[model samples]
Structures are given as C-alpha cells and as structure tokens.
Target: MTPKRVLVAYGTKHGATAGIAEQIGTSLREDGLDAVVLPADDVDDVRDYDAVVLGGALYAGHWSRKAKRCAERNADSLKHRPVYLFSSGPLDSSAEQQDVPPVPAVAQQMERLGAREHATFGGSVTAQTPGLMARVLVRSGKAGDFRNPERIQSWAHHISAELATLP
Candidate 1:
C-alpha cells in the first residue's frame, strides 16, 4: 500500500532542531511513510499532509516563533489530522525530569492542534555551534543542548506506528 504523506517541519537557531527533524523524517520514510522534512518557514501549506510533525529549538523555555506560527496558521487543517510537537532544550547535566520540566509553548497550542503526541528531547550544543549571541549565551551558562537520540528514535517509532494505522 502507498504510505501516507507526513510533513516534518522544524525551526532551528543552531541547526540542532533541523538535524532532529531530518532523523525523524528519515525514520518515518524507512517505516514506509512518505515524509518530507522542511524548515517551518518554508512550508506553504499543510493541506496535502496526512500528518504534521512540528519541531523547534527551545531558548529561554520557548519554541521558535516560526514553528509556533506554522502551527497557528495551519490550525484548521491540523485539527483534522494527526499532529505532533517536539521541542529541544534543557541540556544541563543536572536535569532529569524535575529539573527540565516541560515545554510551555507546546502546551499552549496542543489543544488547538489536536496533537496526538508531544515530546521534549535533549538538544546538542557545541562550542562551535550557535551564532555569536547564542554562543555567548551558552558560554554564560544560559543556554545548552539537551538532545537525546534514543528518545527521539522512540518517538519516531510511535509516530510511524500511528501513521501506519491511518486509513
């Protein structure tokens, strides 16, 4: 059977979220779903997709504005399909679940999107990554990468299964 189409959209300041989205898109395709990965700002419409995966880099406990806008702009179509939200943040080694908490921005749009799943995964931060301002912030201990590959793959699996079950 021809697989359903899935759009994996993401916003990233330092490429980490983009990388995550790539992994997710690849995983979905591998599982026999037709997945297209693109930057959130680049998606013109969500009408063709059977499912939408929106992801963004987290800074100061917020998802990027573009990703948020994508969700808002496509709210009507998204509500009629399966939607998933993922955020990247909380890289401090000291954080477990209690320390990292949850993604607040995603929470605000969850009900509106009728999101089937929401995930908060660790992101990557390197000395060479981020722009000047972001680098400075990271050096100042205000920003960090908290991406987790295992958790990402797990989430991908669940989403792939969900798409498989779609009619």
Candidate 2:
C-alpha cells in the first residue's frame, strides 16, 4: 500500500506556529507517513492528500486570515478527507491553563467541514522579536514562551496512527 499522504498547513505571524507545523510534519514522517508542511496561503488544493492538518496562530481571539480563508475555500474537499484543526496561540504555561477560546467563525466552519479533531497549543512571545507594541506586551508579563514540543510531537503521532487505520 502507498504511504498515507498528509498535508500540514499553517499560518503564522512570528513564525512560532510554523515551527510547530514543521515539527508535526517531522513526527508524522517518522511514524511512517508522508507529510508536507507549508504555509496556508501556499496550499492551493487539499484533494491530493489523504489527510490534512490545518493550524494557525491566534491573534485577538481570531485565527490568521490565511488559515480561515484556506478552510473556507477548501471546505468541500476537506470535508471528504480526514481533517484536523489546531490553534497555536496562548501565552499560558500549559494548554489546560489557557483561557483562549476558538475563533467562532472558524469553529463553525470546522463543524460544517466535518473535522475529525481540533486542538489548542501554547504559544511563545519574545521581547526582541516582536514590534514595539508586542514588545510591551511581552515585557509586561502578558506573554511568554509556553510551547511544549513533546505535546506537539505526541499529537502528530496520534494523527499518524489514526491515519494508518483508515481504509
């Protein structure tokens, strides 16, 4: 049998989310799946892959515009495949501690698209990397690096395992 092909598409602002997507792809590949990581804007179609993992950075309680558009544009194709959604933004120490909510529009879209799973991961912030306003937020202790690599890898492995069982 041909290896299952998975697309890990993401939207990022400061690149933290992109890094997470790449890690997810790597973990999937290690689990004997074929995975490709790309920015949401770059992925023109989802029909070529057997499964898809869409993720984005959250800002002001919203998913990145590119990710939202990707979901909307490819809703039909995505609904027919094994689809997963993830949001990477919450400067909390743990995923459980995050008070952030999913973007309402995106949530509705995911439901309509028959997404298999959805997850929220911790995010990171750095005073040196962000702009002036973001720097202030980081300095004020409102933001900090809270991403957990182990958790990300574990999630990817789970997805790989699930895909392997698909007919």
Candidate 3:
C-alpha cells in the first residue's frame, strides 16, 4: 500500500513555526508517511493529501494571520480529511508544563475545519531570528528556543498511528 500523504504547513514570523513544521514532517516521514512541509501562504490545496497538519506562530495571544488564511482558503477540502492544528509560541516552558489551549481564532478555525486535535509547542527567539523585537529580546537574555524535538516527534508519531487506523 502507498504511504499516507500528509501535508504539514505552517505560518511563521522569524521562522520558529516553520522549524516546528519541518520537525513534524520529519517525524511523520520516520513513521512511514509521505509528509510535505510548506509555508502556509503556499498551501493552496488540501485535497491531494490523506491528512493535514496546520500550525501557526502566536503573537499577543493571536494565531498568525497566514495560518488563519490558509485554513480559511482550504476549509472545504480540509474538512474531508483528518486535520490537525498546532501553535508555536510561548517562549517559555509553559507549553511543556501543561496543555495550552488554542487562541480563540485558532479554536474557531479548528471547529470550522473539523480538525482532530491541536498542540501548542514552545517557540524560539534566538539571535539569528530576524526583526528588531527579536534581537532586542535575545540581547536582553529574555528569549530562547523552547521547542522540544521529543514532544514534536511524539505528536507526529501519534498522528501517524491514528492515520493507520483510519479508512
């Protein structure tokens, strides 16, 4: 049988969310799925995939607009497939400590898309990140990479297992 095709798309500023998406794609691949990672802006269709993973970066308690627009644009197609959502932000260990709920907009998107689940992963703000605020935060020793590869891989593998049980 052909491996399941999964689309892992993300909306990011300063590239943190993109990294998370890549990690998901890698993990899914390890689980024997055909995963493709792309920027949310470039995700024009979801009909070609068996499952979809959509994620975004959070800013001021709001999910990224790019991610929202991707979901809105692909809503009809996404609803027919098993869909998952994620958020990458919270430059702290809070996500590791507890289940962080999706922001309101993301919750609405999840309901609209019939997404199966949502995960919140910690974000990063390294010196290499672009933008004045990011640099300032890094310089102030206030920001660091909090994304955990183990957690991300665990989520992806879980998705892969769930997909195996689906029709």
Among all candidates shown, the one with the greatest lDDT: 3
Candidate 1 C-alpha lDDT tens digits along 39-79: 99998799999899999888778888889988888888999
Model 1, residue 58: displacement in angstroms?
Answer: 1.0
Cα RMSD to the true fold for all candidates: 2.4, 1.7, 0.8
Q: Write the per-residue lDDT of candidate 2 for residues 1-167, one digit (tens) a residue.
A: 78999999998978989989999999999998999999999988999999999999988788888888888888889999999999988777658565445678668867988988788889878875567757878779787777889989999999988988889
Maximum-TM-score candidate: 3
RMSD of 1: 2.4
- Model 1: CA > 4 A from native: 93-101, 137-145
Q: What value does the lDDT take at residue 164 in candidate 3?
A: 95
- The whole-model lDDT of each prediction reads 0.82, 0.87, 0.95
Kindly indicate the candidate among 1 and 3 with the higher lDDT: 3
TM-scores, all candidates, are 0.88, 0.93, 0.97
- Lowest summed lDDT across 10 adjacent residues in model 1 is found at 93-102
Q: Which of 2 and 3 is ahead in lDDT?
A: 3
Over the full model, what C-alpha lDDT does candidate 2 score relative to the true structure? 0.87
Which rank order by TM-score, best down to worst? 3, 2, 1
List, residue by residue over 6-73, the lDDT tens digit for candidate 3. 99999998898999999999999999999999999999988999999999999989999999999999
